[model samples]
Target chain A: MQQNEENDNPPLFKSWKGMYWLVLGALIFQIILYYAITRYFE
Target chain B: MSYIDWFVLLGTVVFITVYGIWKTRGTQNIEGYLKGNNSEKWWTICLSIMATQASAITFLSTPGQAYEDGMRFLQFYFGLPIAMVIICVTFIPIYYKLKVYTAYEFLESRFDLKTRSLAAFLFLVQRGLAAGITIYAPAIILSTILGWNINLTNICVGALVIAYTVSGGTKAVSATQKQQMAVMMGGMIIAGIVVVHMLPAQVSFGDAVQVAGEMGKLNLVNFDFSWTDRYNVWSGVTAGLFLFMSYFGTDQSQVARYLSGKSISEIRTGLLFNGLLKIPMQFIILFIGVMVFVFYQFVQPPLYFNKVETDKLANTEQAAQFRELEVKHQQNFQAKSEQVQVMVNALQAGNDTNVETARQSLNSIQEEGKSIRKEVKDLLKKANPNTEARDTDYVFISFVMQYMPVGLIGLLMAVIICAAMSSTSSELNALASTSLIDIYRRSVKKEASEKHYLNMSRLLTFAWGVLAIFFATLASRMENLIQAVNILGSIFYGTILGIFVVAFYFKYVKSNAVFWAAVLAELIVIATYVQTDIGFLWLNPIGCLLVIFFGFMFQVLFGRKLEPVEIGIEKPLKSGK
Candidate 1:
């Protein structure tokens, strides 16, 4: 089936855990910057 | 503006409409009318999807958004690429496998007719209002800037879209969007460049960025975990993901874009293209606002950019207060302008301490101006009590009208108009498709000929177009263009996305479970939205999860499997009289 063809291909993304961590890190960094600007800088 | 600029504006519209209609002449069958016969290549689908998402508000308000809130709004899209991957893996293949024209068509197969109707109805209500806003947003900008009648602008914009859409259907919509996207991108790039060029000779691009950064306008990321904070990291990931999933994954306006692809791979490629391009495109657009912020630091801008409100205020007794505020604004601008120049020189000379001092000074002055504007608006409201106040939404339109060169001004206007039309035409087409296929064809007339359906579709398309225009006239009272449309979407998309998710993965949950769960979830979502003041984006995830969670519980308690409902995909089980 054509659905299986998608499975045969290397997934568009892999390692959901790693992906989650990467996004988390970016989010953390962004929040830190937001804090610096809003709460601390001025 | 010069006569040539008006000529350019009118010429672009007439030429593009004639071009799209001439190219997409034949839309004979329902498939052709709805999905463009699945004949479109990847790029056409890509452009169509991009154009659909990039409504008029994105152009007119995004820069103003950045001007007010900084670039943190870009974080709201951090989850977009991830959502695209999820949709590609799960949603795309299922819809392709089903060969469904509308996304809700699969709901009946997996659950019941009520579930399908429920999902489809949610989409129609959300998308229909969104279409109104899409048309209304750009028309408001044009009417405010050009001093044209708002009603006339709404009707003209709505009628122009219905003409091409009713004539050529989805094929015309897709084909025209490719050109619209091209024109929009080109016009925006030109505008950005011209904004930089029009900046005072002393301020270079680097200098502008530095000034903007100092003023806290270059802030692009926010990692805060607060649920109520609209554009923070947590909201962007959790809530924003659900919004994107529902918007791209299940909404027929978007699904229909990919449904027109020549092959499954083409659709996947189209979606992936959007996934990769959407964030960067938004960043660039918002960055234009960042640049506008820097530009305004050098130039004296209007105290309130919305002409209608400003005009009314001018005639009021508060005019003196407003004039005083403008004088204070100019004085503050002058002070900040000198500091920016000094900072630029210091940065060039590698004096970090001087740059830091200059940055602090600029930031403090900006805050002072903001506080002063707030006081001024309060004073105005206090004076008149019923006068319209707040005009941050008018900043970008005011900038274009005041600064952009002649022909380019017209082109920028065309870009916005094209965005309005591009999104509205798709909505009108999708609304008509759902109305006919999900409601009329399935429930009202099951054995209609292809010709009958085609005529009915066109008629429905025209009817919805007029309905949107009527709604657009009423949408004038809504505050914040992007937030208003999104609030409308968040009210519905989550429930619809949940229905599809359950159909795809929650196999044990029976039809009755999902149907009742969806109804209950929708009621809960609406009630929660009304009762709370949480950020609108979070509602998307909350709505979807509520339905999924409730559906499981409903099935566990019911014991007996619910009857699966048919949705007229096959021959009628019992012939109608």
Candidate 2:
């Protein structure tokens, strides 16, 4: 019964674009933070 | 080291184990036993993924890696985000659609039985050795800090994790991983913050980072193109992609984490989240190490952090020489620490010339310290041949013990235990699943009922857990736990990932060709690894590419005139009727 139900539903996935954007933003944040802390904060 | 700390550490672990078992109770069949009935939410999957990757060694040795090598190691993970996207698009859909118990199970459907068995066997070998290092890494920290025997600590850490894993299976593994992640992250954040706090009152967090930067420890990104250089943009992007793909895309340890997700979306989200989170998580861990490097500039660090060897040297004829080096090291650190403060002030004033001068002075002092430390290490080796001369892995734990408050010390210790349990439990769970589904049920007892298979999985979990503990007892003689685990993986992951890549994309490749090719490629890869001094990271790509190239060559030479076998993907969770 459970297996049948799982099979019937198309797997739920979020927007790949959204995931990409979030990841890119995170990368930028890390770079900037790392730079700002080490370079300018001193 | 206090009773209060032990209480907190023991209580945290015991509670997590009990809670996990309670939450994951009623796992009656193989599905629940291995993949948690594919009913796990995204958060559960996310935490489980993180827990599996962040071993005790990450907690114990990463700071030391940062302190010694600087933050250049961070570049090694630069390819992970890209690797995640590739796995989600390529690997996830295949596993989800095929519904396989182990990732290797897909190989059988795509190619042949030999291929499936080959992949599973490789994963077992890699993860088996990895589990030992995970347990051994944290046990070293505990035994070192508390002055206990390493073997007993290894047994204790290994047994505690195995106890819970044997009882609760994948469900318990996932549930406890969530708790462990929480504790591990909390402890790390606290530890990072406390390191900043423990610095001399004159040194702000900015000053600490500035000092570290001046000492050349903040070099997070290097665009160098060298295969021999272990952590660089070229190696990280190309070779690192293959390594991550092989590890997350093909290995059962990671495959099983996503397999437990309630839906395809949840698994996808969990993986994508991991892709987003993992690089930064590693960065923070490495950053903590960077901060530690700065902290030591103001404080006089041990000439050698490895107590076992340091103690031996203390009783030797060379003890006076080592003491002289220690005194020289103290004077050098004092001068450099003062110079670093001046450098920070100059940088703050936007004076590039003074900044450059300060940097050079800091570098010269650092060079002198390195020589003295090397002298001490040589004395240690002369005093005790069996002792490790490198103590980079012990730096963070040493800081925690000497600096942190009592309550927080316990919390950080719990974090190490949690990290150990997180990775160890995942390994045990994966090993049990592979043994039962891929080997036992597939080859040994094909006619067993679901209940029987489930029982077998539990038994295998206990058996593998015991095996891991036995391996952990022998893990102490290793040089560095984190690198040792990765080196072990590099030995097998490439060929395993290679077989999967062929199974997925190379349609004309027959199972017999791929199987023989994989075997030969594995041997060649191992031979190259042992004979060469190339950085270990390169092995991942080398092993993988060798399998594909060899598999194709074998197909062209030996696969002609033989009828191709029909490869049908099987439902992994559902027992074949």
Q: Write candidate 2's Cα lDDT for B498-564 as tens digits.
A: 8888777666678788888888988998899889888888888888888889888888888775444
Candidate achieving the largest DockQ: 2
lDDT for residue B216 in candidate 2, whole number 0-100: 77
Residue B294, model 2: lDDT of 81
Question: Per-candidate RMSD vs. true structure?
Answer: 4.1, 3.0
* Residue pairs with backbone overlap in model 1: A30-B223, A31-B223
Give every prediction's interface RMSD: 6.0, 5.0
